[model samples]
Target: MTLRVRDLDPENPADLDGITAVLRAAVPPMLVTPELLWWQSARAPAAQCHRLLLAEDEEGRVIGRGSTGLAHESPEPGLAFCNVYVHPEHEGRGAGTALVSAAEEYLASIGARTAFSWVLDGERNLGFARRSGWSPSRSARFQRLDLTAPLRPLAPPPPGVELRPATAFADDPRPLFLLDAEATADEPSDVGTELDDYEEWLATSWGHPLLDRDLTTVALVDGVPAAFSIAHTDGADRYSSGMTGTARAHRGRGLAKLAKHDSLSRARAAGLTEAYTSNDTENAPMLAINEWFGYVPAVTEVRHAKPLG
Candidate 1:
């Protein structure tokens, strides 16, 4: 039976559910759902130019999924990404290869000169990526913490520091945005991103459907947002940290830890059962913070890259 690859029709309910199932099958811990997929592919900032693709077998069952797009926020030219995930039950059917090919074609059509993707840290996935001309790069560790466990109480903030919910700045999140941009610039990554567009940041990050401003914690210095722990909820019991960082000037003050601790405590109080976060293995500071919070490593993913001709 022949396998075919095509763009996912988000408008079609079956296609949406099929792709969501494929994602869940590939990574059971992922918080992906049809609603989240739609939010990403259809409502994300226009600069992202996101595309979703699906691979179907002769019987029209979706066995693989691919997400592709240009990294619009990056100052570099011709930079793109394509993440492919195939159901474990259908691995030998060439669905992954087909999906990658289609994704690359789409990226090239949009003038992308390079592509990046994440492959699970395993021999099979690594071999497949190497076979596709992708070379290994920096890796990231995903961690999870059980909210049901006894959490360490958050220590009081320093005399001049204040910890509060991000929602307090709903009328003006510019201070938080500035802190995020500064922290993001210093984060360890193969692809350096510059968040120069505040409007774009507002639309994509601030207005995101999953963003839980009420649960997100922020540490302020003299009323200026200096550190934050952004939160995203699955509308269930699962919560994920979108980004946690402290401004350069506030790095040694333990503000990031304070914000994260406050956020996690609030999350547990709000009945959130699970919390997840990921960090570059090279980021010693953040890793140490996660360790202090009792977050255990769940999965490791290796970043891979290939040049486009």
Candidate 2:
């Protein structure tokens, strides 16, 4: 069966549905939707040069999809990423390879010197990356919690600390952005990211379609945003923690836990039944917090990288 690769058309409903279906089948813990896919491809910063690639068989069915882009926010330049996902039933049909090749060519064309990808931790997936000349770097685990289960009672916020919905800062989100920037800089990862562009963050994060401000919880200390747990919902039963972080000064104060617990409770109250989150294997603090929240390990994916000419 001959296959062809092409850029995704966000305006095309069929394209949106096809890619979303493939992603959902390939990675069940992930929360994706047609609207989220559209927003990612359309609102990405220009410097990132983001492209959503689709692999179609001769029958015109989208069997695989790839998200490729530059690590524009990294302090280091010439870094690019391409994460490809193929429907389980279609995995051995060369769709994943075709999508990756097409993605690399595009990244190289845009001045990228190295490409990175996340491969599910399985012999088949790892073998594919190895054959493609990529080497393992680090791994992260996806976890899930049954929000319908009984949650441990949250303790009262320490004196001078308050738990509030992120919506409270709707009038001005710059404070949240600042805290996010600080916390994200400390996240353990192979590719370091610097969230310095406030405007870009506003466009890609603050204005994102899935950001549920009402469900997101923030910990405030003396009226200052100290830590936060950002929430993303599919407008259905699925909920994901986009990010949870605490400011440097707030470290060891349990603010991150406070924020995430409140956020998860709010999500459950809002009718979200499943909650999902991911943390790098080296991030013991966040992992411990999630475990305390009753999140169990779901799957792990290893980050792999290859240099390009």
Candidate 3:
């Protein structure tokens, strides 16, 4: 069957559903929806040159999807990402190769000097990356919790500390922004990111379509935002932790763990059946916290990079 890759039309409902289907099939634990895909494609920062590409067969069925864009927030310049996911049923049909080639061509056209992709840790995936001239760099773990199962009870905030939902700061999210920026900078990754753009963060993260402000818990120390567990729900049973971190000054205080427990409790009470989260292998603190919460290993993916010349 002849295959072709093309840019997705975010405004097209069929395209949105098609891509969402492929993504859900490829990464089941991810909290993704048609709306989230639309928001990512439409509201992506222009500097990133983000493109959601779709691979279709001659029969016009979507068999693969690719999300490619520059790492504009990285301190290092000209770094780009091209993550391609082909529907499992369509694997080995050349869809993955076609999508990757199209994504690389686009990245290079936009002045990218290097490209990075996350390959699910497996012989087939690793072999594909190697044959495509990409080498493994780092690995991250995806974890899942059966929210329907009993969860650790939420602990009362210690004296001088208070827990609040992220929506409480809707009037002014700058405090949460500051905490997120600090935590994000310290996250382990191949491409280091610096969240220096407040307006950009507000647009991309604060106002994201899937951000469940009510489920996102934040801990305040003496009325100062010290730790937070950002939550994203698919407006259904699926929920995922977008980011969970504590300010540098509040480390070892158990604030991050507290925030996550409260957030998970809220999610479970609100009928979210499953909770998913990911952590870089180097992020021991977060990993430990997840394990303590009864999240079991789900899958692992290795970051692979290739030079663009």
Regions more than 4 Å wrong, model 2: none
Write the residue-wise lDDT of candidate 2 on 1-309 in tens digits: 999999999999999999999989888999999999999888889999999999999999999999999999899999999999999999999999999999988988999999989999999999999999999999999999999987899888989999999789888999989998999999998889999989888888899899999999999999999999999999999999999999999799899999998988888888889999999999999999999999999989999999987
From the highest TM-score down, the ranking of the candidates is: 2, 3, 1
- Please give the clash total of every predicted structure, in order: 0, 0, 0
Q: Which ten residues in a row have the lowest lDDT in candidate 2?
A: 263-272
lDDT string for model 1 (1-309, tens) is: 699898888788888899989987887667777888877777867667798889999999999999999888778978999999999989978999999999888888889999999898899999999998999999999899999997987769989899999889999999988999999999998788999889888988998878999999999999888999999998989989999999998898899999999999999999999999999999999999999999999988999999887
Assess every candidate by TM-score.
0.97, 0.99, 0.99
Q: lDDT (CA) for every model shown?
A: 0.90, 0.93, 0.93
**Distance from true location, Cα of 243 in model 1, Å:** 0.2
Candidates by lDDT, descending order: 2, 3, 1
Query: Considering only N, C-alpha and C atoms within 3 Å, which residue pairs clash in candidate 1?
Result: none
- The superposed Cα distance between candidate 3 and the true structure at residue 106, in angstroms, equals 1.2
